[model samples]
Target: MNKTENSRRRGDELLESLYNATMKLATTTKLTNLTFQQIADEARTSRTVLYRRWSTPFDLLQDIYSYKAKKLFDGAFFDELKDNGSLRKDLLQLLTVYQKVHTEIGAEIINNYYFLRAQDKNDNNELLIHKQAVEKHLNATKKILANAEKRGEKIRKISPITLMLPYDLIRTENLIRPTNISKKRLTMMVDEILMPVFVG
Candidate 1:
């Protein structure tokens, strides 16, 4: 590789390492025990990189949350959302993936984020990151709904927020109770809310 290519590769490696370190710390340690120094040690890099980029752990975590949330929505989570000729099946699978994300990382990260944000309400950056992530998911959900509509389902007029009903409910369930959401509950969400919205 040329010099510039080498430099880019090195930068990417460092960033991946840092992000991995942050995620590891978030998952393994208590929220109160997180520090850039610890992350640096875990990542085998200098703490200055984190300090120069983010003013606080919350800021770094905002990036982490946004990145992971994007991956969750755009990555393998949506791979099976194509026209399967069954809206119920597609929705159930999608909800199951969303629930997996919540059970795996979303619950702890989001809970810690709210706790930290409550301690310092001036962090508009975190809020912006959060809003962007939510919007991304909303768009993805709309795409899925559009697919169902194209498949001859009579989807009703619904606002963006309303489109997020199933996802929001799963997120709330994760926050309230850190356990695997039952497939029955997911089916009920579809039968009770999603089906009505699409078929009503």
Candidate 2:
């Protein structure tokens, strides 16, 4: 490769390494505990490189926050969902991934996003961004249900609130337990609670 191509590839690799380190650290500590030194150590890099690229931890954090948002519900997550032919399988896929995220870094991610959002109440950009993310997920869910209907699955009419019930229930449980909701429990939720509502 030429110099420019090599330089671009190196830059991408650096960012990926930093991002992986940020996510791993996020699982173990609060956002307030994150530091350039810690991230550098986790990424196995020099602090000087981080300092040269990012003026403050918060700048790096903003990039992480945006990345986490896109990673969670957009991009490859949705691509995998679209390939699942069964609604039940689709629900399982989404929830299984979500549970893993909750178990790993749910609290830190929540705290970081809300803390930054709270810091800018007058701006409202944070709220708008969050709302847009939710809408995108909801639209994906709607398409899943629509596909099920097309396949002649026995599904009842569902309201928006009912469609959100599974996640709301999971979030509530997380607030109480702050751990990964087990696969068995998630399956029970889909089969017993969420599926009943959709099919009956």
Worst 10 residues of 2 by lDDT: 1-10
In candidate 1, what residue range of length 10 has the lowest lDDT sum?
1-10
The list of candidate 1 runs beyond 4 A from truth reads 1-50, 67-70, 73-76, 104-106, 114-123, 127-135, 150-152
All candidates: TM-score: 0.66, 0.59
Q: Which stretches of candidate 2 lie over 4 Å from their true place?
A: 1-61, 82-86, 101-106, 118-123, 127-129
| Model 2 agreement with the true structure over 1-200: per-residue lDDT tens digits | 33333324457787887878887887787767789889877777777777888887767876667766655544345655553777787777766666665555556665566566666668634534556657766776787788888877877887888777755666666766665467888898788877777774
What lDDT tens digits, residue by residue, belong to model 1 across residues 1-200?
A: 33333323456676777778787887788766789889877777666667877887777877766665655544555555565576787777778878877666666666765677676657655555455666767776787778888888877888888878768878777777667469888888788877877665
| Whole-model alpha-carbon lDDT for candidate 2 | 0.69
Q: Candidate 2, after superposition: displacement of residue 162 in Å?
A: 3.3
Question: Which structure among the candidates has the greatest TM-score?
Answer: 1
Tell me each candidate's RMSD, in Å, in order: 5.8, 6.2
Q: Against the hidden true structure, what lDDT does model 1 obtain?
A: 0.71
